[model samples]
Target: DASAMDKKQKQFDKLINEWKQKCEDITVELEASQKESRHYSTELFKLKTQYEESHEQIEALRKENKNLAEEIKV
Candidate 1:
């Protein structure tokens, strides 16, 4: 009976060790993904700002063209 109990305890310990190892792996992977996402977000913000600036410049050019047309009519 004592040997059977020891064997059962060893199996339980092995399972617990495997579970802990898997949890550590998952935590590491999550941290890596979070870091990559943050980097992408920063790049997206910069690109968005550049797009907005270019759009404003285009609007200004259009207005200038309209003013020139009016001058020609007058």
Candidate 2:
């Protein structure tokens, strides 16, 4: 009975160690995922800002062209 209990204890310890390692690995992976998410989010924001600015520029150019056309007609 004593030997069996000792063997069981050893097996339990081994399983605990394995679980601990797996938990650490998962933590590292989660941190990496968060970092990548932040990077992509910043990039997306920059692109959106650029798109808005370009749209404004196009509208301004169109208005200028219309004004010039009217001036020539006069």
- TM match of model 2 to true structure: 0.93
Least accurate stretch of 10 residues (summed lDDT) in model 2?
1-10
* TM-score against native, each model: 0.87, 0.93
| Candidate 1 structure quality by residue, lDDT tens digits, 1-74 | 99999999999999999999999999999999999999999999999999999999999999999999999999
Model 2 residue runs over 4 Å out of place are none
On TM-score, the candidate that comes out on top is: 2
Residue-by-residue lDDT tens digits, candidate 2, 1-74: 99999999999999999999999999999999999999999999999999999999999999999999999999
Error of 2 at 31 (Å): 0.3
* Each model's lDDT: 1.00, 1.00
- Candidate 2 overall lDDT versus native: 1.00
